[model samples]
Target: MQRGMYESRAYATLLLKNILEVADPMHIMNLKPLVFTEVSDRISDKATKAALHILVNICPWGRNRHKTVEAGAISVMIELLMDEITHSKIDNVGSNLALLSLNLNAPYKIHSIHME
Candidate 1:
């Protein structure tokens, strides 16, 4: 999946979201890294948004919030927010970022997220 083109990855992420509706914890853990990677990829906003939506769904589960923080989702979401704000192109990303912020318990780490 990593070697696929951006469009393919975007489609795969959307498909994964559908699968995650009935997925187990093990499935969540296995998919988290790839989803987070796609969130930061920026090669396609479609892919990024799909990945962020997937994270929003899985983050509320047991231990997934901490794992998301460890995966650097906060920083990536913040970066995405900054870009969207600057460009005035905010979309579904705002709610995803908001959900992540509310779910994560790592306030101490927010200051460390790079803005530039």
Candidate 2:
């Protein structure tokens, strides 16, 4: 998957972006905990970042955002961010931050709650 990102960035982004349109994003939500575990287990810059990018990108849509939050993304991402901070992996830090930001903002996307 990392290699695929390098081979074609557009395709990689598109693949992640389009996952929200699937027949059942909730199914994907169901497996997200396992996926989150795998992401932390992988711990490689490219792999983890790709996974986070995919997860975060899918979160802007209201339903997808709710599903992602239900998947424990906030907690998982916080843990990942802490780990990345300890190692000072600047490359992954940006992605981790983005994931956290998206994860936190996801709840607001569910309703009329305004976000500053």
Candidate 3:
């Protein structure tokens, strides 16, 4: 999905979340960039939450976990978490981060979080 397509992006993210829930192969789409972009886009809460849901569904898979870290999901997730912490509005972002941390590249992912 494109950046300008806010409503469409939200719908697409929810759709992907449902699809991922039904199946485990998250690699079905070029999801890395899409999720990273959406998760980092805090302007739209619907899109961000839906993207985080997608991460929650996909991150349990080893390949998708590493793909999330490679896509800079860790840093963006940390930012989202920090935002949540500051606002006292916690949700699944911390869970998503924990899932992403299960990747083989834990050192790199932790370093990225620190860099953020």
Candidate 4:
């Protein structure tokens, strides 16, 4: 049987919880590459944004490590966020506010973002 797309918010929550509980730099380093492909497949812009935001927050960043997230995954997520912000209509104030917060608070530095 083919594996289904990740549908469990609970699973995501638990995974985040577990990762935070351990909080190991080496573990984060190991996991980054493994998660890249799966994360890239999540095409929905909102979902992608949410997932990447969570990943960035959970992974520890500093002068030495600079977050455990893989470069490939970060690149893909940045592209998706930029596309969504540029192409989507800001009809809902709440969503716009949330997106704005994410844009401001997200761990990665995004330069020249366009919101549509």
Quote the RMSD, in angstroms, for model 1.
Answer: 6.7
> Which candidate order results from sorting by lDDT in descending order?
1, 3, 2, 4
Pitting candidate 2 against candidate 3, the one with the higher lDDT is 3
- Colliding pairs, model 3: none
CA lDDT, every model vs. true structure: 0.62, 0.50, 0.56, 0.46
Best TM-score goes to which candidate? 1
- Candidate 1 has what TM-score? 0.66
**Residue-pair clashes per candidate, as listed?**
0, 0, 0, 0
Q: Please, what are the lDDT tens digits per residue for candidate 1 over residues 47-99?
A: 66666666666766666666667778768767877776777656644654655
Cα RMSD to the true fold for all candidates: 6.7, 7.9, 6.7, 7.5
Task: Write down the lDDT that model 1 would get.
Answer: 0.62
Poorest 10 consecutive residues of model 2 by lDDT?
Answer: 107-116
Tens digit of per-residue lDDT, candidate 4, span 1-116: 01644456435544553564456655544554445445444644454554554454444333212332343555565555555555654343345345545544554542222333
Residue ranges of candidate 2 with Cα displaced over 4 Å: 1-45, 89-99, 102-116
User: Per-residue lDDT for 57-100 in model 2, tens only?
Assistant: 44554455555556666566567666767786767666556556
Q: Score residue 66 of candidate 1 by CA lDDT.
A: 68
Give the poorly placed runs of model 3, Cα more than 4 Å off: 24-43, 90-116
